[model samples]
Target: MRSSDFCIAGGGIIGLTLALELHRRGAEVTVVERDIPLKQASQAAAGMLAVRDPDNPPELLPLSELSIDLYPAFLDRIERLSGQRVPFQTTVTYQSVGHSSLRPAINLPTGLIPGDDGLSRLEEHSLDPRQLAPALLTAVRNTSVVILDHTTIESAPPAGCLISTLGPWGAPPAAPRKGQMLAVSVPASFGLDYVVRTEHIYIVPRLQGPRAGQAVIGATVEDAGFSTHTEPASLARLRGLAAAFLPAVADETDFPIVDHWAGLRPYTPDNLPMLGEIEAADPGSTKRFVATGHYRNGILLAPATAHVMAELLTGEVPSVDLCRFAPGRFGKA
Candidate 1:
């Protein structure tokens, strides 16, 4: 029988990050994926570290704060271990406010926004997940981490502990929020460098490496169950939204539509990720744990999620309170 200190059931960013942390602590780790690593929402993420996004749940604030703080060190470790460069695409996010009663200011110091008409420029960060994925994969491969790609894990893997980072595959009391996103390559002088967000859509620009001049326009969140299919109509609507914000995207002659894709995000009823031990099944069963249902914040929450999970597995005190994200809260997750 194969033995490992941990056998994680998902090979996405969350699983891989947590596996790396565990292996760093001298644990034998094996990551099992149903298909391949970084093939799902991991690569599809816009890579926004939106710690100050007002739309986020209030319960997520503490974790988000810890995550954004850990981001620099996280990327640094990934690059150092993998021998790759994953630079931040942007350091500011401009959130547009419509003509209405003004909301509370975001409380972020800002200088001159390129076009600061009615946008709230916040101190945020963004990166290209496409770049992050390969670095993380390479880093894990360079370690003692054993990755079982194209492998389906049983309910309980033969390990001292089993962590279910398995996105929506077996999530409970949760549904897959399908998202459609498209990307376009603009000229270096595209006149836009920061991330942009409106009520319905977001635009993120890449500022470094071969990905520079690439802007990603995303994301239609639908209740479509596990549909990997991208709708042309939806893509057109997304393009229209982008054009409304930046008219340059409408002209395909100058800026070409490079890629389009669809993926599913695991979201719980409360919209909070399920983390921590599976206490409901057996009060004493620390052998099984879950860390899924991150929904739209998986990219933002990856490093923090791994940090806490590793602490939990190693019997160390968690950095943040996990009461609000307890798995099995909806009955035996």
Candidate 2:
């Protein structure tokens, strides 16, 4: 039996980041991932570090702010360890109000700038998850971390306190959500330096050297189970939304199609992540813990989550109040 101090399931950003943190704190960690790190939602994400005043939930703001602040240092540490530069830009994001009566004018501060045309400023700032994920994985791997790919958690460990980071699982009946997304290649002339968001559309720029001139546009939330299938209907809906917000892309012939994909974002009734430890079956035992349910903020909250998890594992008091995100908060009432 493979043994380690900690075993993390789902190697995406959150799992990998936690692995790195655990390793940094001198704990041996084994990560079991179902697929490649960036191939899932972590790669498909537009990498927006948003905190729109309107969208910010009072309970989650503190955690969000803490994560945002730790990003710079996080990136620096990853780069130093992996020797790869992760691009992070403080661009202005805009939220264009459309004429559709379906929704009202909504503005929010995002960490990305809208490069497409005809979008008004709502908020902006940006980070490249594509670059960040690989950088982090590389750093962890360099430290002799073990990651088992294409492995699923058929069943939780029978003994150690099982901490479920599985986004869609809670208590008993699990409800997983699926999201769709697309990647398009744009010419160097696109000149879109900011991330743009409309009532239902968002566009982010590519940060890799090879795809530097392109942009990744997408993301449609659906209740289609945990399947990551990119259906034509969803792609059409996304393209239509993009064209409406950026009139310039209305001509399909002018824009080059690159890639299309989809992923699952774990959702819960409260939409807040689950964190903390589980008491061992033996009444006085304290052996297992969890830091999951981050949903979409998994990337943004990775650093803080790692820090908190490390504190828990080391018996050190965490610097922040975890009461709001306590895993037991959602226990059966």
Write candidate 2's Cα lDDT for 1-333 as tens digits: 456767776677777887788788887777766666546667657778875523446677777777778878888889899999887653676655444232432343332223333345545567777677778888988986777777666532322333445555434223566778777766656666767766467777774555676666777868887687788888878877776556565556666667787767766567777667754566775365667666666677778888877787668998678888775666731
Error of 1 at 197 (Å): 0.6
Best by TM-score: 1
Going through the candidates in the order shown, the clash numbers are 0, 14
Give lDDT: candidate 2, residue 54: 38
Q: Please, what is the TM-score per model?
A: 0.91, 0.82
Evaluated at residue 110, the lDDT of candidate 1 is: 30
Off by over 4 Å in 2: 1-3, 34-39, 96-124, 150-163, 169-174, 279-281, 284-286
lDDT (Cα) of model 1: 0.84
RMSD of each: 3.3, 4.9
In model 2, where is the ten-residue run with the lowest total lDDT?
Answer: 108-117
